[model samples]
Target: MNEIIRLQVALETDAEQIRNMMVEIERDETDRWYDNDERPFIPGYDSINMQKYHMWDKKYYKIMYDDILAGVLLISYTGREHARVDRFYIEPTFQNKGIGSKVITLIEGMYPMVRLWTLDTIQKSIRNHKFYEKNGYEKIGEDEDERYYCKTISEPIKEINRFNSDEDFSNQNFIQCNMQNVDIYDVNMRDSGFTNMNLESGIYQNSNLSNTRFTNVNMSNAVLGDSNMNKIEICHVSLADAYIHDTNLGFEEQKAPLIMERCELRSSRIVDSNLQDLSICNCNIEGMKIDGILVSDLINIYKSSLKTEINKM
Candidate 1:
């Protein structure tokens, strides 16, 4: 007879139980799949360490069947507004059950936006793709190799104006607020501290964000078109998949920061942003800047083209 299972968000004390489940899952996954030289999937100590650290954040969930550890679901926050369903796995013995779908439903009810990624190359896991589609996620886009399918969760809350216009938000400590899809046009946001906030898919046109401080914020998939971001201090911010066209980022200085890693910066004009000190690894920067300067070994673009354009000035 199949036994009923219980699902709960893991607490810090459940670390030991979760760790053991992770080990079992890794062993089972590795044994079933053969490792390729190019993309080998090795179960290592580092992966366990990551699980331990990530579980402490209270974002992970552990599934138990008949009071025994079954599997784990890893949830990572893209900020406060968006959460990514990083890893969802059930033991081979527990496959074909409704555990995965139940967990996804729980996540969708709690978070505004949840996303998960799967590979199309995994023919064996084609049922997994169908499972997600059955659970209300849509295939938004895909990467090269026809693998890495991005699936988005249900729709976000739609309000004409979610941000308070009359409130004196300047010099306030804001944390983990959702400003997605809000029309924040032509506003002056200065000397504000926004940490771990989600500004995804939000429009910030003709807005002024001078001397604003942003740390650990997710600006991914955000539209910063035609915004003025002068002298802003942005550190450890994720600009992944952000659309930044015709924006003025001049005179901005980012220090020892994680700026624009794994992002696309198409048609964005960045000038005099002391980006020389920042790391521009894994970013696609296009278009021209009048005084664009580069100074880090991390950026290995066409130096002659950049220099020639600079020399002409």
Candidate 2:
């Protein structure tokens, strides 16, 4: 399981390092952020820019991932109901690992009273445009060299289709959409398609999962309790350290590697699964059986030999 990402307030001691990172970001965009027509001269990228924006309403947060610094976020609350994301930059090495989206989601959850959230990005950066759009932001307009995007938080719920009726969904594409908080219990999803979709906190109990596929899907903090998983497949999915309690992994043949660590199995059989590199430590074993032989009987035989050795001594 991965640790949750967080943002801490940037301290005064972090000023110089933050400025250095900002400078690096500016240099990464050499031809961008230049002046076309100067209404008023502004230092677009400067070391003392934070000091200039040091106010009660403005905030700077240091992005922390797994207890390590990974990025920075600067925002301002201009009014009681409005907020703006002034700037955000993640380390280049940590760009596309879902940290940016998670950080933005956390920020939005932090400010539930905020109605209108706005931001401006360089128009030349096509990737930036796609990112904001994927996060449900609408492109309102553009000015000089900046593209303005806004997301109204209190907008009406748009109607969305949530159920499928015995339809084949295999080999289809569904990207950057919300399927969160939807009921999928006892649904026929065999050979279905789910890619890059937010199915967070969705239920999948008593469903047909044979030949069902999942890639890059967010199943964070989900429950897979008391479900039959006979011949089910999963690849590259985030399970959020799920608890698969009181179940048996019975497979006639192994296809992929299975890893079981820090778990408890009582009165269960591990058949035909890949146990290569399997480790069992710090476990209480009594009346155990392996390969149709009583393990406890074997240990007792070995202990009897120890007693014989003691009699010889």
Candidate 3:
């Protein structure tokens, strides 16, 4: 559809249409997602008096699509890179035409300085969860009746290419930033944090990463050499097509001869690896597979063959 979606600052004259539009939305959503008996719900657009009262200090916008009133949004912007969607809804007729998603993108574009956008949804509304999650809003937490969500906006520094080297950035907070292609070496990063970061194809040499926690990290096609990983704990991680090598002088040998000892592997999958002369003792072999065959099935077949040979004897 060739449509132009935009947001305009709502005026006092637009109160009646907004009230009627919200009524339409309330009627459509009644008994569908949330209970009608819910208390402390949004009553801003319920009537003209409430609408004007709530729109006093907030930036209320009338969502316009093709010069038509498609929806209404009440945003509470602090002008300091934080905003919240107090209330947002599309008219019943304008629902499910991809207008709601486009309007959200429009709001983000309108407030380029906003680094965090937060909103709340009815906790029981699974459909709404799918919609918001698909648009990059993560479900942060849930209360008695509502669920909170927020999306962090990352704006890359396009002008600067090289960060000054030999700098002490310890305890410095870097939030909502895109630091791709940044390089560093021989720095004190201890007692620092790297959350929601991307280190794909990154190089780390002669660095101290001891006592660091990496959760939900993807280190695919990467190398870990000449590091002290003794007594390190890993869980629920993917090591597909990966190699583990033991070396001397704390240096990884080119020829990987894995010698895993004192490891507790629970519910882990080892697929398509070389295990010649490997001994497995005191472990669970139930439902284990080898070469696309189950170990239990092979054992049963061997038992049946042995019984037949004894009867022939």
* Highest TM-score against the true fold, candidate: 3
Q: Which candidate number would show the highest lDDT if scored against the true structure?
A: 3
lDDT-superior candidate, 1 or 2: 2
A best-first ranking of the candidates according to their TM-score comes to 3, 2, 1
Candidate 3 per-residue lDDT, tens place, 32-121, comes to 655558533554447776566545554788889899999888886643456778778888788788987897898888877677788888
Model 2, C-alpha of 128: deviation from truth (Å): 0.5
Model 3 per-residue lDDT at 205: 37
Candidate 2 similarity to native, TM-score = 0.44
Ranking by lDDT: 3, 2, 1
lDDT (tens digit, per residue) of candidate 2 on 1-313: 2866899888777767767766766665553444554322213445554433432233778888897777888776544455778778886667778898898899988876566788888777788899999998899999877899998786533453334546766556765656544433224566776666666665443346677667776778654532556666564444444544334465447444455444445566655444566666676667568787877788799999999999999
lDDT accuracy of residue 307 in candidate 3: 100
Off by over 4 Å in 3: 34-40, 157-313
- Clash totals, every prediction: 0, 0, 0
lDDT of 1 by residue, 1-313 (tens): 3666666777767766666666676666555643552332322322444555556457677777777667777665543343456567787777776777766666666665333333233333456668767765556555542234445443555542234546655555544555454544224676666676765555453457767776766666554533466545554454554433322335347423434444345555553244455544444443333444543322345676788899999
> Which clashing pairs does model 3 show?
none
Kindly report the root-mean-square deviation of model 3 from the true structure over all alpha carbons: 20.6
Q: Point out the worst 10-residue segment of candidate 1 by lDDT.
A: 37-46
